[model samples]
Target: MSGQLEVLNKKLKQAIDTRKVLETARKQQVDTLTNFAAKLSLSCKGMDIELDNRLAKFRSALSKGVDFENLAPLIAEILSLLKNQEAQQLSHQRELHTSVLTAGKLLQKTKGLPDDTRRMLRHLLDHQLNEIQSTNDFIPILNKLVSIYNQALNVKLSVKNTEDSITQPRLAKELLTLANDLVFEDEAADNVKAIKNKISETDSVEDLLTSAIEIIRIVATNISDERQSAQSFLVSLNQTLEDLHHSIVATSKHSESMSTEFETLNKRIESKIVNLTKQTQDATSISSLKALVDNELKSLSHDLIAKERLEQEDRQALIKNFHDINTRVGSLESKLSKYKKRLHEQRFKSLLDGLTKLPNRAAFDERFNHEFHLFSVQESDFTLVVIDVDHFKSINDQYGHSAGDKTLQVIAKALQMSIRKSDFIARYGGEEFVLLMPGMSVEHATAPLEKLRQAIKSIPFKFKNKSVQITVSVGATQFKKGDTPLIAFDRADDALYKAKKSGRDKLCINS
Candidate 1:
């Protein structure tokens, strides 16, 4: 029983020893795998950052978010495939090490073989050599291991040759070339076919390094090129914007200058109009005075002739006296007519507008009173329209006051054109105008007023070198029974005010 216990203790000791060896090997393998996985993880993470940066830059070119749903899965699949390949390589490396140990033991067993037996041993060794050479481990390490095995075999075979020594190095060189070609070909065969071909065909590790360096260089070059292109585009855009700004400024200046010219022209036209109206009034008054003077002269001549007949004895002396009185009366009559004509001419001239050849406010007032009384007495219906320019001050400020004046004149002309033969239109103030329509009610007046409004809106006024648009606010009212001219005018004025208040370039009618 003591001997049985001793055997059991020995078996337990052997089992403990075996477990220790297995634990050590497992620990080594675990450590290697951990280190390898850590390195690969770090490398893959770096690649991911680089790829993300590149993709971020690419995505920024689009206006919307990138659609990476399909692409994300593809990238994940690639990472999994790489992990599997790494695990297989590790397994193969362990297997290769075990095989090398086994081969070493076999060589040791054949150490004392005879020549014929040695040849057979050499064949077996060659087969093992082929197996080692075909491994997936690092080519240089695999080649070195195979060379060591060959050297050991050669020693046993008593074979010595300088030529054989060169063979392994040549094979190593070929294998290295093949490895490089395989990696490069795989990398180069991407979607960008031309770039792939260029990468594949390149020779030398330095060339590969240069190519890799060039990738970085190309990225830098692309960044620089993009910067330059962006700069150029910005410059061009700035130039275009600057040119547009200049054009707008020039156009604004031109409009202002034109407006000023038009205002001056309008003033001249108004002055001319005022003068012509005055002249016409003066001529009419002069004609009336001349008729009165002619009648007086005829009466005086007849009275003188009758007086001459009354004194027959002193007829010759009477006739001479009468003729003298008649001459003096005729001369006085002629002088009076001339003086009246001059006065009428002066009055007419005073009532005229120098710029527009139209009646001034004073002339309009005089005619309005006269016509108002006539219409009032006759019990005739008439409409009065007050037209005011809209945004006259703004037009002057933007285009210049000269343009404002031109706008007024253009509107005045349009009013004149729109009126009937019986209708009277006149400039009531600077930017205010008046139109009198006979036998028209406020409702009936709207058609003509709107027509006038549309006409003015349609007519383009050329002030200086610019064409300007203008509109008028009109207030119209019909004369009522027992209404004074002033009352009628006041109603029209209120309506005009309402039109301006509601909005400029619209019509308002006083009921």
Candidate 2:
């Protein structure tokens, strides 16, 4: 029994050792699976849920005392998942590398950007694209790229716009050609020329640092050297523009003053003519002369011969006075004719607008007064049309004043073509035009004016390589008896205001 007990204790000890070995092996397998799963969790940061679930199932099997037969397959499946994850990671890495390279190329292509801005773009391209490890992280970088691109494009467009406005293309091209030749000839340093040549070969911003710094320094030195000259030119330009504006305003005022003075002088001459004609008619009246002659005979001698002689002398004296008065009136009429001729030929020319070659406000005033007088005398029908260019200020603002001038010219031409020879057109002021249609009532004038409105709208105005449409608001009114020309004009102007307020490009008649 002692021997049997000792044999059992030995067997028990051996069995315990074997069990310890098996338990150690089982722990190692669990640890291996756990370590693999942890590695997969780290690698599959954004992996599919199916893969995660499979990994969870393998872990659950391991925790439930999985046999080697089952454990081996689970491990094999885990190994397969790991391989696929690695391949996916490799593909993502390659894609990221390719994207970074693409960004580098884009950075290289960008030119004329300031150093700080270019550096900011490069920093984003280099760091942002590289740090992205998954699809979810790519969006911000793409959006950042779009913003950077827009900023760069805006800067380029602004610079181009300013350059185009300030510099004439043909002159700028010539100047640039001359500058290039002078730069090459005047450059004394071989190192600078070599650096410039090197920079000229490359389009990349990264490769241009040294050349750009040197160019900036040279530009700074040149600017410092020419600062006084540049300031003088700028001052001269500003002074010239101011002088031009002042001159225009002063000339307009002077023209208006001259027109008013001429009108006053004409009225004075007409009044003098009327007074002289009345005096002549009163002196030559038959009843007044007979009464005067009868009184003179009563006071004269009773003898027939003396009375006849006195009567004959009085008749000759009266004839002489009448002849003298006629001669003076003829001279005055001749002088008035010459004055009218001079006014039409010379003064009216000044009253014409230089831009559109249309009659200006001064001329318009004279014509308006003449028409008013004619209407008063003949009682003929007449209409005044006041047309205003719509949003003219915006056209000038968007496309320089030159373009605005062109638009005015085109509109003026169109109006001239649309109107009859008897009708008169004038540039009343800045963007306002007046038309005088005589012998035509408001109803008769509307059709032609509407046609003119349509013609103006149809003109496809092109300025600086851009297409624009033009429209006008028209006002029409008939001349009424006992109403001043100015009052009639105001009514037409009011109609024009209504037309403009009511979406423009239509005719508003206030008759």
Candidate 3:
């Protein structure tokens, strides 16, 4: 009985050792989870406030050696928070992609953006946006935007005004009006009209400028077409004239040659007649006379045959000449008609203003150059004048542009009626007019310009059912020896500046 009790005690000791081992392993597993949760909580800090709070709570509970069963819900809560943040981030990145792409396109066209900077931007847009998935992909674009902003500020401070430097809002509006006046052909015309249609008072400057660039390209193409047509017409006309000249010389030579041929033929016929008469006189019998007459008739026929061939050749040559003349005349008539039509088109499209029906800047340039040439050669009296409507912007602002346009139209008519027939007037640009007064010195032109100013001031005008009085400032200058058109124009412009400065409704002259 004592031996059985000893064996039982050994078994009990073995079971106690096994329980202690399992308890130690369980404590180690809980310690490992708590240590891992501490690290995860640190990473989650500042990710989101709610995520940080939930992670902090989960980490605190984990430190208490919570079992996996009790910790599963907190782990699930952290996952949900992380997923919501990821979705919000994705939403933000999508919107950013659109804005960045659009901005890049516009910055590429900015006039003053440096080439190196532009190249970098282009590179970013081409390589980055194609498969962009996150905000990190736009890092290069973010860097470029800062650079572009700085460069734009530099350019704005230094950029001087030019034809393409249309910065003012009104300048764009004015340019649209002038752009519409240009006419092109076929697809080119439609392209220009399409671009013009896109223009509006409310469009951004970059959009409007982009449209302007496209319109300029279309206009340039039309000009090229016109040049090619004119060149072809000139070449054909020259060839036709040269051929007609050669034909005329050939006809003159042929007439003299024909006259000489006629004389030779007449002499040959007379000689034949003399020979026949002598032969007939020498006949001794009736039969011999008949044989001699037949022989003489055969010889005369041979001589007449050669003459007939020469006459036939002359008739064929004359027929060809007439045919050539008729064909050339028809060709010339057709070309002249086409040339006339082109010239009319050129005059209307290139030289006349669409709105006021007056001569435009190009016409002014042509006339000014021609008149200056005459002035230099003849040393005659020639004057140039510049006129500006007083308070024109005020009129437009208060009464609207339509009323302002009417005022300009009436003002243009009044100025036209006041000028002499020999004098020329043109719309220099917006709210400005230029005059070329031949046969008038600065002294003579001053009085007339003042009178014209007074006439413009007295013109009765109405806008928006209210009466408005219009006035003008005049500046005049006369051509002198060794003066170019540009010099004369500058003088008139300077005088105009003085007139406006002295006060409205004034006339100033530069000799």
| Best prediction by TM-score | 3
As for lDDT, the candidate ahead, 2 or 3, is 3
Task: Give the per-residue Cα lDDT of candidate 1 at 193.
Answer: 30
Q: After superposition, how far is residue 404 of candidate 2 from its true place, in Å?
A: 0.7
lDDT of 1 by residue, 116-187 (tens): 545644554456444544344336544645665575677655643444455433433333222222211233
Q: Residue-wise lDDT of candidate 3 within 1-511, one digit each (tens)?
A: 8888888888777777887887788778757757876896787699689999998888788767676788899889988998998998888888898788888888777788778888887887898677776778778668777787678767766675433454555655665676645656578767765665556433366777787787778767777887999899999999998888888778778878987997898798889899889988988999999998898788789879978888898888888887888788888889999899979987777787655668888899999999888878899998899999989888866865556667777888888999999999998877899999999988887778888888888877877678888888888888888787888899999999999999878898877
lDDT per prediction? 0.63, 0.72, 0.80
TM-score for all models, in order of appearance: 0.36, 0.35, 0.55
- Using lDDT as the yardstick, the better of models 1 and 3 is 3
- Candidate 3 has an lDDT of 0.80
Instruction: Provide the global lDDT of candidate 1 against the true structure.
Output: 0.63
Model 2's alpha-carbon lDDT is: 0.72
Candidate 3 clashes between residue pairs 3 or more apart in a chain or in different chains: none
Candidate 2 lDDT by residue in tens digits, 1-511: 9999999999999999999999999889878877776566556644766677777776676557667687787678767877887798779877866875686567557777678767767777668767877766767776766676787788789888777555443332222222222221244334344554554344444455555566557656655755865566556556655655655565556556655655665565556556555655676677775665565455333334444554565566556545654655565566557656854765555677755779877789999999999999998989999999999878865775556667888898999999999999998766789999999999999889989999999998887788888899999999998899879989999999999999998899998
